[model samples]
Target chain A: MSVENSDLLKTPLYSLHESLGGKMVPFAGYLMPVQYPLGVMGEHNHTREKAGLFDVSHMGQVVISGENADQWLETLVPGNIIDLKQNRIRYTMFTDDNGGILDDLMITRRENDIFMVVNAGCKAEDIAHMRATMPDHLELTELNDRALVALQGPLAAEVLARFTSGADEMDFMSYGEVEICGAKCFISRCGYTGEDGHEISILAANAEEVCNALLGEPEVEAIGLGARDSLRLEAGLCLYGHDITTKTSPIEGALQWSIGKRRREQGGFPGADKILGQLASGDIARKRVGILPAGRAPAREGTEILDAGDNVIGVITSGGFGPTFGAPIAMGYVDLKYSAAETPIFLQVRKKKLEAKVANMPFVAQNYYRKPK
Target chain B: MTTYYSEDHEWINVESGVGTVGITDYAQNALGDIVFVEVPEVGDELAKGDEVAVVESVKAASEIYSPVTGEITAVNEDLEDNASLVNSSAGGDGWFFKISISDDSELEGLMDADGYKTFTAGLE
Candidate 1:
C-alpha cells in the first residue's frame, strides 16, 4: 500500500515514530514502527530493564453500548460477564460450533458499556461475528480513530503515573479514564510482557503529542514489533496466528481457565459442549508447553518435535533466542505424555537435532502488580 | 597480501599461508544487530562453501559459509561474549576465524575488493 493509504490507517503516533527514525513496516494492514535507530535488541533490553513505549494502535478497539450489553456479550464468550465488576477486564475467547477458538480478546466492563480490544489481524472478522450474534439493542462501535499505546516494564507504572494522576492506585486489570498531557484518555493497568504496565487509549489526533510526552522520559524507550514478539514469547503469551488459530481450542491451548467456572457448567456459548466435554473427560491428545533449547541454536516455528526414537509428536508454534533468558526458548504442542515439565524432547533444526526440555510457562517471573485488599 | 570475498558475504585477508576471515560490512548491516555468533571449532577442516558458523540477529538467524577450503587454525572467542563487535567492526576486529589454506589456487575463484564492491552495489 502507498504511504498515504497506509497512514490513513495509521495509529495516533505515526509521525512521531518517523520523526524518531523508526523504520515503518506493514503489519496487520497498518503501518507500524518496527524499530528505531538504536535497533531491536537495544529496545528489548530497555523494556526489560526499564520501560519500553509501544504504539499498539493497530489493534481494534470497540465499545459495546446499550442496555444488557454485558448479558448479550456473555452469550458469545465463555467469561462470566455478569460477575465482572465495573472497570475490571478479563481475557476471553470466542468459540466456534465445534469448540474451536475463533478469536481471543480482552473484555472490560464500564458503568454503561462494555469495551473490548481484539487482535489487529482478526478485528474485522471478530466484529462481524459479534454483530451477527449480538442483540439488536446492543450497538457495536469500532473505535478506528483511537490510538493505543502500551508502556510495559517494571517501571511502567512509575513512568506513566507522572502523566496520569492516581495511576498507581489502579490495580492490575482495572481501568479508568484520566487526563494525560491535558488530553482525556483511557488507561488500563494491563500488558502482554508479564510486566507491570499500562495500555493507554487516546484520540488519534493527540497520539503524537502523548507519545512525545512519554518518550521524553529517560526511562521510556521506543520498542517495535521485533522485541514485542520476543518479550511476549518469553512471557508465554500466545500470538494469535501462530499459537492460537481458528482450528485451535482453548482447552488444547491450556487456556481453559479463561472459561469461567459457571460458564463451564452452563454450556451456552459456542462450542460449549465440546469444550466442556474436554474439560471434564480430558480428551485432549496434546497440550501446549514451554520448550528450552539446550544450546544457543533457536528452533523456529514449524520445527518438528521428536521423541526418543525420533517419532514426530508436535511442531513448534513460536521459537526464538530470548534476550532476557540468554538462551533459546519456544512453545509448542506435544502429546500429553511428553508435555510434562522437564520432559526431554528434540527439535529438528535443519539437519541437526537440538536437545530441549518441556518447561514451565513464563520462562521469566511475571512482574504484574496486584493490590492487597 | 591479498583479499577475497565469498558469495555468502564473508571476506578473507590472506598473508603468508594463513587467512583471516570475517563477514563484510554489507553483511553485518543487512543482518542488523548481531546477538550471538556460533563459531566453528579450531582445527576443523572445511571445504569451500561449507556452512561453518552461525550469526543470529534479533529478527532471524543465518549461516556463515567458509570462503575457501582450509583447516581452521584459530577462532575469535571474544564473539561468544560480545557479539555486537561484528556490528561495530565487521571487517576488522570482528574477524571470525583464521585458516591455513589447503590450496592457494582456491583464491582465484573468490572476488577481489573491487569486484566485491561492485557485486554488493548490484544487491542494493
Candidate 2:
C-alpha cells in the first residue's frame, strides 16, 4: 500500500514539520509527520505534562448553512443539532442505515452556520453522502483555505491565552472566534489527548506564523501524529479506521452517549431502527471495552480475545503502549457478557494466549475544562 | 571481541565462539521508544535469519533476526524489567541475548563496522 510521493498531498505545515526533524509518512493520502526528533515517548510525555502543539490541518473543515440547517443535520446524524447551543461542540458519528459507523466527528453550532471537523479520510465520502441526500435549501461548503491545529495538555490554556483573546475564559467544548497574529481564527476549547486543550482553525496562509508564535512559547513543544495517536488512545478516544469502522455500530463502539436524548427518541437519523432497537432492548451482542494486558507484551490490533475457557470471544481493535500509564492498554469489542470490569480474558499474540483483563477506559484521566454552574 | 552488523540493523559482538547480540543505534532511533522485548530461551537453536527476539515500541513491533546460526547461550534479563535500556544503551548493557556461534564461516558474510556504516548511510 505504498503510495507514490507525487500522489500524496501535503498540508500547509508540511515543510515546517520537516524543518523540525519530523519523520514523514503517508497517511490518508497525505504526507504527514508521524513523529519528531523528540520521539513518540518524549512527545507523548510532553503533551501530558506541558503544552504540545499539533498540526491537524489534514482534517476536513466544513460549514453547513441555509434554511432549517440544524434540523436537516439531525436527519443525517444522531446528535441533536437543532438543540445544540451556539458556540458549543458535540461529538457524533455518521452512521449507515445498518447502524454501522461511517465516521466520527465534531460539530459546533455557530451563530449562522454549523461548523464541522470530520475525519480526513472520510470527509470526501461524507460530503458526497450529504450532497446526495441533502434538500435544496441546505448549502454545504468545504473549507479548503484553512488549517487546523491543536494545543493540548495541562499548560495549554496558559499558552493559548497569550496569543488569543478570551480563550482562557472558555469552557470545554466552547467555541469562539479570535485573532492570532491578526489572523481571524476559530478556537475551540476541546481536543482528543485526554487533556484540557484547544484546537484552532486559521487561514492556511497564516498557519506558519501562528504556529511559529505558539511554538515560540516556552511551554509548547511540537508534537507529531505518533504522540497524537498514543495520547488519544490513552484518553480512550477512538481512531477512525482502527477503533471504529463501517462494520461497527455506535452502540457497540461505546459511543451511545454521543447521541442526544431528543435524537434518541425522535429518531430521525440514519440507523435509527437498529440503533434505537439496541438501545431499547439493551441486548447488544458485543461492546467495546478496555483491555489491560497482564504483562509487558502489547497485544496489537487484530489479536483475538479469548475467554477463560479458550473460546474466541472477540478481537482487539486498537492496542498500544500507553506512555502515561506505563503499560500496554487496548480497546476492543468483546462479547457483552465479558465486558465487565476485571473480567479475566486472554489475548492471542504470536500464538500465545496472554492473560488480560477487561478494564475501564481513559487509562490517563481526562482533564477537560469545565465551568461551575 | 569483534562487532558485526546485519542488514536488519542488528549487531552481534563475537567473543570466541559466543556472541552478544543487540540492535544498532539506527534501529533504536527508527523504532522510537522501546517498551517491551521478547527474548528467546537459552538452549534454543536458531539459524541465520531466524527471529531471535521481538522488540516492541509504543507504536509497533520489530523482530530481531539471528545474524549467524547458533545455539542461544543466555538472554538479557535486564530487558524484561527495563526495556528502555535498548534505547539508552543499545550497544552495551541493552544487548538482547548471547548465542554460541555454531558456524564461524557465517561471520564472513556479515558487515564489518565500516561496511555497516556505509550500508546505514545509504538508508538515509
Candidate 3:
C-alpha cells in the first residue's frame, strides 16, 4: 500500500463515498472509505445476513491475450490455466523462484483470452514482473480505465437480478460480459468474502452511476475495507501481505488445494521442486491454523503464540473480533505437530497467556452458490 | 462535581476526592464501534500517565492512560456484557473505573471543560 502522503489518489466513487458519510483513509495509494455510518460491525453482519456493496477499484485488472496465453500463464502460476473452462475463474498465485508467493490473484478464462485481478498494493510490481518474464507472443493489457465493485451476501443475486437478466442463473466461479444499467460490464460470480456474490467490472466513467443504482436497492448497503477485512478473516481467506508473504511458501500457507494436480505431477511452474516435494511427502513443517481465543481480548498481529510450558511456538499473523461469532478469533502459523483442529495453543496477549484452541476454517461455513448437478 | 479532561481524551469527574473516569465522546466517535475494554483491577495502584486500561475497537486497539495519580477503588462491571456503552454514552454509563486520588494536587495539571475543548480543537 502506498502511503506516501504526497497526494492520495481518489477512485471514481470518491464523491459517492463522501456523500454516504464514509470515513475515508489512505489505503493502497488511494483514499478509500474504511467504514460508513453503519460502522464496521453493522456492515459486517449485514453482509452476512443481507447484502453489502464494496468498491474494489483499487485492485489491478489486466487482460492476457495472444496465442497460447493460458499456457504462458501456467508457467507463472501453479494453477492449471490451460485446462480452465471458458468463463470459469480459478484462484491462483504468482510464485517466486524459491516457491514464495509474489501475489495471489483471480484468473478468469474469457472467450478469447484470460482476465486476472491482482492486489492493488502489488499491481505495479506484478505488471513489471510479467513484462520482464513473458515472451513477446503474449500481450498484457492493463485495464486502468475500469472500476471494480463487489456485491456480496445471500441476497446479492436477488438484488442484482432486478437490473440484469440471466445474472441469477450464473453459478459460482462463473462469469459473463453483460450490460448493467445500460453500461457494459464483465461480471464474475465470486468475491473474497465466503458468500455468494458477484464482482462487476465497469468503465470508470460509469462506476458512480452503476454503484448508485446498486445501492438504490433496499437490501444493498455500502461497506468499507474494515468490514471487508473482518469478513474475509472469518472466511479464512488470506490477506496478501499479512497472512501469506514472500517468506512463506504456498504449502506453509495451507494453499495446497490451489495447485493443480496435473501441474504437481508435471513439475512445471516456478518453485515446483520445493512445492511438489512437500505436497507429495506431506513434509510441511508449519501450517496456517485458525485460533479461537477463550477470552474477548483480541490477539492482534505479532502476538506470540506459546505452548503450555510457555515456550514460543508461533506468532499471530492476523487476529481480530469476529462480529458474527461474537468472539475474538485469529489465524497464525503453528508447528505441524500442533496444527490439528482441536489442538490447544496459548497466546501471549498483553503480558498474560490466554488459552486458545485450533479450530477449522471457514470459522463460518461458506455459502457459495454451487449449482446442483 | 467538576469534570477534568486529559490530553489523551479521558474525562474524570471528581467528587469528594473520588474520581470517576472514562473516555470522551470525541474518542468514541473516532474509534467507531467498541468491542472490548480492559480496565485496571480494583486495588491496583497507578501513577499519572500509566497505561491503566485498553479499548479495542473493531479495527484497532488503544491504551487508556491514567490522567492523575490514583489507586483504583472500583471498576464498572457492566462493560463486560455491554461494551457498546462506551459508544452510546462515553462519559456516563461507560465510566471505566473509579479511583481514590493519591494526590489531589496532580488534578491542577489537567484541563477543565473549556480548556480541553480548546486543546482538542487545536489538535484538529
Q: How many residue-pair clashes does candidate 3 contain? A: 0
Can you list the residue pairs that collide in candidate 3? Answer: none
Best by TM-score: 2
lDDT of 1 by residue, A125-167 (tens): 9999998888888799999889999999988899888988679
Interface RMSD of each: 1.7, 0.6, 0.8
TM-score of each: 0.90, 0.98, 0.97
Tens digits of per-residue lDDT for model 2, A214-245: 99999999999989989999999999987899
Question: Which tens-of-lDDT digit does each residue in B1-124 have in candidate 3?
Answer: 9999999999999999999999999899989899999889999999999999999998899999999888999999999888899999998999999999989998999999999999989977
Could you tally the backbone clashes for each prediction? 0, 0, 0
* List of clashing residue pairs for candidate 2: none
Give model 3's TM-score for chain A to 2 decimal places. Answer: 0.98
Model 2 DockQ vs. reference: 0.90
Ranking by TM-score: 2, 3, 1
User: Model 3: which docking level applies?
Assistant: medium
Better of 1 and 2 by TM-score: 2
Better of 1 and 3 by lDDT: 3
